[model samples]
Target: MSQTPNRSYADIRKALLAGEETALLDVREEAPFAEAHPLFAANIPLSKLELEVYARIPRRDTRVTVYDAGEGLAERAAHKLRDLGYVDVALLEGGLEGWRAAGGELFKDVNVPSKAFGELVESERHTPSLAAEEVKALLDAKADVVVLDARRFDEYQTMSIPTGVSVPGAELVLRVAEIAPNPATRVIVNCAGRTRSIIGTQSLVNAGIPNPVAALRNGTIGWTLAGQQLDHGQARRFSEVSEVTRRQAAEAARAVADKAGVGRASLAQLGAWQAETARTTYLFDVRTPEEYEAGHLPGARSVPGGQLVQETDHVASVRGARLVLADDDGVRANMSASWLAQMGWEVHVLDDVPASTFTQAGPWQAPLPALPATEEITPQTLADWLQEGDARVLDFTASANHVKRHIPGAWWALRGQLAEALARVPAASRYVLTCGSSLLARFAVAEVKATTGRDVYLLAGGTAAWVAAGLPVEEGEQHLASPRIDRYRRPYEGTDNPREAMQGYLDWEFGLVEQLGRDSTHGFFVI
Candidate 1:
């Protein structure tokens, strides 16, 4: 977060324009990263540095530049990279503000590159779409048209067109025929924004679905802009696919995947890829998070196919890494692979694998790595500190989690703005930090200690440990010290976003293709 001699935005632009390999990183949380950032900047927040960096940016000596919006997080992140043996790490001169000052454009939302690529797909392939007015007329007339919302379940529940059922992009080809068995029935695919709708509609066309299909142009944004009513609290989801439907969907998806040059890998082939230590191999299960949580292949992380395509950089930061996707139904994996392959990743769909291969079940969370140097205080010790009133408790976990439950009397603070918030707080002799797992609190220890010149300690296992120890805790948004700016409030995320905000969001997405042209750093290719 401190200023130092590092590469300017111009330097980064020169390298990108020259086709040189570079990793321009934004060392911040996803929310702010989604609010505004460079088109090609990969976000690897400081809290997850140890957990994700090695796999994402594998080569230690690879040229890397880190930046933050003067938040003081970047310098520590750069140091962590060096400690991990990265020899060519530096800060971005002027951070986000500097980039703007130098006439570099900032884009909103996660996965801008993938979204831009989707726009490119539509530009080249001429994916067809219908205006909100036209779709509204069909719904009013009760035409035999099935509308599919190609977004995550929660997103669909937020706001959707009338009579639209949830059928995420990955499931479009797999479930379209089942939804519209009559060949004469019309089909409509839509999402919160443009990318998923366009890509989902195109997937149905590429898979050769029986029904005539089109996207709800510009998605919910366009619907709202056109003064069309949107349904909220919708719960309808796609029905279970029959064996016949599954077979048909697999054949349809596979043909498109083959045409897109996506590879088909066996479990043995995936094992071979995993054995290559020098290469980064990401194994993902492209199914709904609920399905993944119920049962999934061992070592395969849950990244639903639709979200994976929309957020490729978020899941796999290493551009050239080998990606192997798995899904019990096969269609989602294959369809997702087709898009990823064109995005310039060496992607494969695991084929002919039985459900028996998914021996692991229940909820899965990534294991937390140990944080050295910082002393950890047990829950019992923290209880005594609370009773004695000598230590100030600060919870660095998400506000949503804090609202559910946190240590009694602990003030919630954003990790990136801890220093700024500490200045306004009543200084304590001892400062103790806690989060859901305490992994993030460990990263904050040094910064808090430096800023306050007080003793700092991490809650051994975080709030979860405190609960496990049967300690009393408070519930609700109590004792808050910082605002929840860690993440941006997405217009398509909740049930209550204003129509104007939604329209503005659509306007932002509409201009991304032009922004992509200006940046010209993203190495995206559409098939």
Candidate 2:
């Protein structure tokens, strides 16, 4: 391991306050990172270290401080990064506890930077909004108005205002005319919480949309607090854009994009930018998740403009990296890029990129690297082994996927935690591995063999192949060897969260502007 140095919280804080380039990463799962972290620290999770670090912290020499809550994870992360050719990796002196001792602030929830910026926008621009009672009254009277949910479709499905159509933040300007049609119809934007609703409403106003627009103040949280009813399982969505409306929205968005000083790049220019080895370039498709999953540029990530603005830190942890955004309809990318440019990103919109370039699609993700060589066992062979009790199966897949379907008796294990996880399982005559794709399982074969000193094998073609071959699979969290710490459960994600937790979440968001003021690291500038 490289003898990487340690960085004091005070020194890190000073560098942040001075606006020097730095990435303070919390090398823990999203749950713990959300539970508490320094305001500007981005959660990269040690499990995803190799998968995400290169793109997030683009500059190899950019100073990076990794921390955990005394979990002894930072050192391991630092070493792994060194192996990956990161030049300036360091530990946050004493980890989370050390920061606390140094009198640093700890924040709750993810995307604090974007949420804080939304508060700042409202403070500076005085964006108009309607309280729950007022919006409820409007809906009750059948006012000539349309309520647009400016969140993800799943979020809208979880809970929404009655009669509201799903029009995510980036789509507000592009699809508003089609949803309301009538120039005189009022539009009310909402999210589960405040950021998207505020930004979505402001997006229309900024784009010069004719209809009077307002945000549902405090979003669903406020509505729930006000003893109002919320709609569930609603599938209403924005209709396709008419040619005339598309042109108008595109023209308006381009104007805002220009005002924000966002640049335009041809495909060739973007390719050149991507070719540059010294800096990180993040190419995003700023359309809806469904649209992105349908098709997008091969190397581009799906961020859906509004979420890109709301979770900028999550998308690009390196403060100085360049951003290139794309959308089938130009309006979304332009609007999203405008906000990012204003927020001090070196932002641009991809122009004149051919529709053919967007042929590859289906859930944006990091491409898997080549796995280490391992002995392979056919699904039929593995099934026979299981039936004869000759081998034990471990599935190195995501907890959610493992819950959905897996080999009947397979144990779920995270590849990063394999060493510790081995203690939980019964000693087997031989070990077998599998995952949804089997690629990740292949990556772990060498590690498991080295750690356990046992013969190990990878199931050929994984669960998909097994299913294709008509093998029986079991569902649910039947054999979890590790806690499901990979993802953070958001207060607004499902219907089961306590109302008090949701309310407290909203309350915390309301105070982010104050928190941003206390933490001077954020160099945000709104247009």
Candidate 3:
């Protein structure tokens, strides 16, 4: 194979400063990518390249650069991109070390850009915040206060402030009025850590909400450090908005979007943007997953506005691509577009569209490369093969899932490292590949067959299908062919994280504003 072209840190930084379209991808597992990377680098691990590349970097001709920390994954990823029809793939000169040598600032953790922007917003606006002890005193005294958790509902259910209601970030501006009702009621917003709480509280302040609002400083991390107990399995959520509240919220959200210089697009204009072959345009439905699954605009991906802001690189890999947002409730799209615009994206809110216009139903379907037809096997038939010891099952599901439950004797394998994994498994007459839904495994059938020169078959519906058939399964790490590095466990995610890790995470966030100053390419502004 020919060598991929190398791009220096100066070259990539110049394009970003010029506002040109570029994709700076870090081809390492999430754990390593989270340790340290350049400011604009998006984590697209080499293992899941085929699964995510087409949908993320939509325009094949978009300038793309891939890098890794001296692991030799960059060249492999560049070669894979070429095979996938990407014409402008290149390797970052000197890899991660090279970027450091060139004086590029390295950032830690996922969603660095959004986290930095949140800190910047706080510094510029002096957004009001209350310490955990103060908030606890108010709760103890039964003051006229309402604590709204701005993290996802599931996260809230895991561990939340006492009497904290689940009101995700995007829903803050839309639902805060009804939740607080009286203008004198004090409102408190919080998340597991700092970013969401700051952004959520600032959203209400920016929209001119009547209530006295403040973020729970350092979020749940602060609460825990103060020796406060958190309520688990809480289900309190925002109720339906009144017609009067809806109108007020819509007006407030629109004004905020306008102040941020966010653009508006009619359905006709959106169609024209979608039809452009030269420019990559992403249409996102910035609503709750339930609302999106019930009905959404065709071609719109269901990315809750809060998550879309937090994980911009994950959803829209192309840095300079145009973003179009949609929501039945007028407040969500506008509020979300405002933040995207502040983040230096050319964003537009889909305006004047009726709720009935959202005709698409069910979950978002990702675009995938066409697969060659592969032979299939039924769950029962696979059971027979396993019983006869004639076939080796290669499960391509996530390592965590495989450990939780999998076919009795199946070996867990990563599709990207199939060659290495294959050598570890005992020789068998045939191989059956499977995953959660067999989608990923189908894409690997050709490769597995070519490598082993053996008959390879796909499990009709993957391991999920086998479970549905009431087939016996077992759980253990007895047959892992590849290491479990696909996902990075965030220190603030689950309930059992160590206290030291949580405090360290808070300290890291407190320093983000200074980091943003050092890396001046982030064109962030507060309205």
Candidate 4:
């Protein structure tokens, strides 16, 4: 991961504030970087840096700071840079993890395109927004006003205003008819904080969605500070809390638990879940494919939890199915479960992990492991079950690297489109998930569980693990090339798909990409 010598956080933060042309480089996995990052940090994963070193960080002399989850991964990355001849390379004193300790900010919401959209919203108003009291007065007088929560349904469930309905940011374009169905329904977008709502509301204005739209000034934080009452759902509590705001969100979480009311399943209930295998019973690892291959449950999918939830529909079609989730990091399970609760499923976290009926395959994965040994599920079993219940199969074997190879009958569902793609699955079915290695198969398990809440299983290792274990390996991302936005979120993900997602994806894509090009801050390392 080495790039060059070094720099300091204060120096870089100042340069950023002063609008200096410093390149804020984050050298972590795309998934982790996407979770939270600096406003201007462009991701250039440590893995791919060796190959695309110059093209990515064109300016050899630009100041660069690298960081990891505090494992000193950055130091190694720095060394890599020095060998490559890039000067002015320094590790983030603590990386993103360190920034938090120093009280530096961490941002959420994946689409950087949304940030541009927010600017458009701010410009539309041109003037400061009405005060809370002013809006309250209008409500008392029954003036026309509509508040829209712009986050995903999963996010909306956690916490929202009493009367607001879920209208995700991407929906402003596709579901405009639903939001302002009558033409007079005023729309206002809001999230826990400002950016998402600001961008979401503006996307409609930019797309000409034909409705009076505005943003909830300052988002949920503003509402609560105004002494207004917020609504809590069975599983979600509306507040501005995160790993970044855990202490603050605690009260809200409890209120949400109280309002919607959730209870842990008893041992009997847990046993019942183990018995329901009519559909695919997927056990996903939710880590990188490399991590998955290192060691995971014998049979599980390998969709990383973040990617799984983000691309739910593409993984499975079942709406009311059963899903079980697992993650080495409990935070992933906790954060992921919050979303699963909203999608509606019989969800379990398997807190005891290996102690339960399911056991982990073994220890950590190497970059890629050869297949293991196991007899195949007879075609008779697959064919017989295909009739009674439901099932669909996908092969992530392409690895998002350079289409290395694929499973014989695997289909390619790009991580981003997996959600909309999988919406077509039947609720009462099951499916076998495969990838080049067993690691990704387990991750696919997490995706299936989070999205469709259906049953699923993994090939003992992977297609490779299976073949090494004596299964099979096909070749490609999918059977058909229907044109997709397959660009890896990071350099290590390697190159392939379009910089932007597929057309008509979630409604707000095209315009956002266009604006992103226009805003010349630091270019997106992953787009």
Candidate 5:
């Protein structure tokens, strides 16, 4: 009767929290990890470690700790570590959830959109702007001005000023020279939301682009709300993907990839791990802790790829030890494996492999679940609203892109602040929930439905897709709250805590211009 070792969570916490040198092993699958995870854990599956412990860990004297979703997994893993002669091995009490709830850095995706937006805000001083009427008036009066739409070509195609040229947010910094040719051009940048527009104009102004760069006031929203006609079909005001197309795409991707594990070892290699009596088994689940908890492999650890990539050495200190990766899905595995492979270790991404236990366990929970819309809505219908100008709509983007510039009366609100924002919003009018992509926006609509339960629809494809359509975007400066910003800072400045405050702090402190897809609750949008 070999039982797993008993370890105290407090001891593991003491070491990690105090920044002491210790090995933190995570054993969880992938897809769930994609949602969120510990900032300093590595992935190594028990089955994989059973074969490659000596070759991988190669150290019998290191202080190694194993964790999973409680349920006696970590203890079993610890005992195996001992049998393999790992001099000092312990189990994380309460497994993944305990570590995260105790202020550990839990990670989500790479914090991309938010950072992209931050780049925009930092480049210029709010790029304060004026309305379309004002800009048109200036043009009519022969004012010397050039307009820049910091959106994609598709966005431009959807709706854009005849004179405005498309320049995606990332491209603005390098391409501003092309769009705002002369210093006297008076450059103005706009996107459906304020981030891109602010970033674009600010980039030029900050870099001292000789011309005057300003955001269009109220962006396209102002243009339409001002009783102006939106160029439809030929030029839409924003992006709209047909529901049929999106659903088809989703259906096409129906469970082809394992989403969590990759680079599986052959039977021989697995057998080697099991026989490696002189090594420690470090199982790392790159998925988020919550995902690990809902039910992961019997002894899989959790790392949540982002953290694993950033803090590899810290988690798997054995420079050459075995690292088994499990993601909630392949996305995290693929993304993390690319980085780990470059670090000179024998790293394998184990995915497309199925565990019989997982299939039999029923539905696994999502680490971060978005609120769903009570009523189903179509993109064309939402597009109709933008073209008609019959109603003023707010993006109500989550932190992913938080509300930027809106038509004259449109507004922006934090996902956590939805209740208050909605309370302030008129109940009689319909509202639009938006995020980077429609994933979170759809959830936002769901939250609204569950709470205010008002007439709300998600922005088709979110604003990024909107910009892709070559839609008219009103440029303006909208400020985001970030610890890096001179005016704001986080308490401890961390990325591991699953706490709401920490999420917001990390969203800013970690250079995420657009992090956490607008909503703070379980609500989120997949980019």
Candidate 6:
């Protein structure tokens, strides 16, 4: 096989500076990729490269530079990209260490671009914020204040400020008028950490809403550190907006987007862009999951506005690609596009589209490469094989899922590391492959067969099917064939993270504005 060509950090930086289409991919698991990487390097782990690459970098000839932290995953990923028909693939000249050696600033945490942008917004806009203690006192006093949790509904349900209502970031501008109709009512926004809080609060401030808005300083992290009690299992959510409120929100959001230089695109223009084979264009439905599932524009991926801003790399890996955001509610898409435009994206809000035009219904489906057909076995058949000791079960599900619940005697394996995993598992006459839904496992059947020179069969419907058949299962890490590095644990996510880690995370965020200043490649400009 031909070795992948190397691209220097200087070359990548030049492209970014010039707003050229490029994909700086960190071909490592989410866990390690979050630790340290270049500012624009998107985490596209080698383990799930096939699953994510096509959807993320749609243009086959887009410039792609893969790198790793000396794990030797980059070359393998580069070769795989070539096999998958990605025409312009190369390796980072120095990998992670080389970036450091070349004096490029390495950022910590996933979604560094968004986090840094939040810090920049706070610094430039001076977004107001009240500490946890102040907000708690206001809640205790029954003051005319509303606490809005700007995280996802599930995260808000897990833990929230007492009296806090779940109004995710994008929904805030649209729902706040209804939630706090009185102009004197104080509105407070918060997230698990800081970024969303700043962005959400700033969204209202930018929109020129009548209410006095402020972010919950440091968000729930500060609330926990302040030794305050949080409401758990809370079900509070934003109510439906009246037509009056929706119109007001639409007007305000459009003004903000205009000020931020966001473009307005008609459906016809979007179609023209989609038809252009030379450029990559991503169509996203920037609405809540339920709203997206109900209906959305054809070819649009469901990426909630809040998360689309928070994790741009995950949603739009092809840097410099044209982006079109759609929302039945004008507020979310416009607000999201405003931020995206400031972050140097060529972004547009789909204009004047009626809800009925969203003819497509159901969840967004990722584009995948064609899979090879392989022999399949029913849950009962696989169970019988296990009982007869004629087959070894190799699970290609996420490590965390395997540890939580898996088929009895199944060894957790990574599809990308199949050869290594196959060597670890005890040899059998045949191997049964399964994942949560068998999506990934289906892609690995041919590779496993070639590796072991034995019959390989896929578990129809995967482990989910097994459980549905009332089959017994066991859980533990005793059968791990690959190490667990697929996901990085965020210190601010769960309730039990050590205090030091939380503080360290906050400290890192506090320094991101300075880091952005040092890097100077981000084309961010706050409105």
Best by TM-score: 6
What's the lDDT for all of these models? 0.84, 0.86, 0.91, 0.50, 0.50, 0.92
Question: TM-score order of candidates, best first?
Answer: 6, 3, 2, 1, 4, 5
**Candidate 2: minimum summed lDDT over ten consecutive residues — where?**
364-373
lDDT of 1 at 406: 88
**Clashes in model 1: which pairs?**
1-72, 1-75, 31-487, 31-488
Error of 1 at 187 (Å): 1.4
lDDT of 3 by residue, 11-60 (tens): 99998888889999999988889999998898888878888998899889
Tens digits of lDDT, candidate 1, 440-470: 7887899899898999999998999999999
Measured by TM-score, how close is model 2 to the native structure? 0.91
Q: Each prediction's Cα RMSD? A: 3.6, 2.7, 1.6, 24.0, 19.5, 1.3
Q: What TM-score does each of the candidates earn?
A: 0.86, 0.91, 0.96, 0.35, 0.31, 0.98
lDDT of 2 at 444: 78
lDDT of 1 at 316: 76
After TM-score superposition, the amount by which residue 243's alpha carbon in candidate 5 deviates from its true location, in angstroms, is: 48
Candidate 2 residue pairs that clash: none
10 residues in a row with least lDDT, candidate 5: 518-527
lDDT, candidate 4, 67-142, per-residue tens? 7666455776788676666677777766776666665656533434334334443544452344445555656677
Model 2, residue 383: what's the lDDT?
Answer: 89
TM-score of candidate 3 against the unseen true structure: 0.96
How far residue 3's Cα lies from its native spot in candidate 3, in Å, is 3.1
lDDT of model 3 at residue 307? 84
